[model samples]
Target: MAAKRILLLAGDFVEDYEIMVPFQMLTMVGHTVHAVSPGKAAGDQIATAIHDFEGHQTYTEKRGHNFTLNAAYADVKEADYDALLIPGGRAPEQLGTDASVLDLVRAFAAAGKPIAAVCHGPQLLAAAGVIAGRKISAYPACRAEVILAGADYATLPMDGAVTDGPFVTGPAWPAHPAWIAQFLTLLGTRIEP
Candidate 1:
């Protein structure tokens, strides 16, 4: 398959694994993944957060590596990319409120391009008003928001993923293998084992 240009939406406090794994995996498979964050420019970095389950009521958060942005959000042209990826973390909560981020997501949805959102990532999709009537999987706590956005939500195992048309979603980073594989299929990418 020809190399595909993929757009990755991220911000400060984005999930460490969610953002890094896919970015690295896609690049390894010959895809050009551009990581961008609103109000940030190329070479700028966003602090990442590591979320782990430790028998707590909710996941615990720890400081993670500072992820560098490869592109400037203000310069992104959604039409130039073949797919969109949104990683879950505290970033989406604020990114979802940004008009630019929402517009970027809407453009991808409008073009029928593949979109992958994991964990809290769907919050941005809901904010963009693109998940209505679609089926998706997200962090369990995001269930209400997903339903409120008119999407049918499913709770999947941590390592599971679901694909509905151009949308691929998963519960968390643990679902990376499945989530990313499904997305690559949608983007017409093939990787040999």
Candidate 2:
């Protein structure tokens, strides 16, 4: 398979597994994954949050590992990458408000490049105004936002994933296996068993 250059959008309080797993897994499969966050440079770290469902009304948050970024956000050019990966977490709440981040998402969308967003990552897409008329699957709590953005919000199992045109989304981290698999396919990557 041809090596693809993937851009990952992340920020402080990003989900630990959501960012780390995809970064490592995609790189292991011969892709060059550059992870970046606004105002952060290479070697800069973002604190991650671990969300666990321990019979609570909502998932509980805990401090997670610090994730070292490999790329600087200011240095990224949308044309240099084959696809974009947006991981879900509290980060999206802030990332959605960045003009640069929204512009980046718009560039990927206009280019028809594959874009993968899991959990709250779609919040960025909504903020960028790119999901209109697309079918999206995100964390259940995001249903109203997804619908308000003019996308069809799909109610999916916790481990479910959905792909509509150039966009791929999942409910949350548990859907990573399927989410990544679908995205790899979109990137024209073949993993031989």
Off by over 4 Å in 2: none
> How well is each residue in 111-130 modelled by candidate 1, as lDDT tens digits?
99999999999999999999
Angstrom error at residue 145, model 2: 0.8
Runs off by more than 4 Å, candidate 1: none
User: Model 2, residue 7: what's the lDDT?
Assistant: 99
Listing every candidate in turn, what is its Cα RMSD in Å to the true structure after a full C-alpha superposition? 0.7, 0.6
Candidate 1 lDDT at 108 equals 96
Model 2 pairs whose backbones collide: none
lDDT score of residue 105 within candidate 1: 97
Per-prediction tally of clashes: 0, 0
